[model samples]
Target: MNPELAVLYAKLDIYGEALQTIKHESGAVCPNFMTCTCPPCRASYGSWALASEAIEKATKLSQSASQPEKPMSVCTKDEPD
Candidate 1:
């Protein structure tokens, strides 16, 4: 995976976790707590969640693709049974 992309994905993951924690601790008095129709809540949980999921999937695919395939091991005729 690209180093920059990896870093950005990691940052997003942290941000998502932080938001979750905040939401859990905050009450309904908080605009973005639980389920709010506020613009910030929509941007943070709606758009940001979608973007984070996309980035996470991309990161996983890139990591899996970059992995080296294992070479098949062959027994040599000279090897003892």
Candidate 2:
């Protein structure tokens, strides 16, 4: 599957479907392909890394944009999520 398309699907929150598309288009299981040590696999890893970074940046941007601005306050050690 195209790295760009994968990034798009990730942004759209359709990861399982994106992975399926990648498996169909590339004819390789996602994990095996990602970790393969051959030259092509190494290149794919680089491409995938770039796409992942882009997706992360976009997600952060969307989240930050959607949030209301507020002042930060220090929390005590007892605080929890």
Predicted model with the maximum TM-score: 2
Q: Give each model a TM-score.
A: 0.39, 0.48
lDDT tens digits, residue span 1-81, model 2: 999998987767776446445434543334676778877777766656656666667679999999999988878688678
RMSD (Cα, Å) for all candidates, in order, is 8.8, 11.2
Writing each residue's lDDT as its tens digit, candidate 1 over 1-81 gives 999999999997897676555444433444553378776665556654555566577679889999999899998779678
Give candidate 1's whole-model lDDT: 0.66
TM-score of 2: 0.48
Q: What value does the lDDT take at residue 62 in candidate 1?
A: 84
Which residues of candidate 2, in runs, are more than 4 Å off?
A: 1-31, 71-81
Residue 49 lDDT in candidate 1: 59
TM-score of candidate 1 relative to the true fold: 0.39
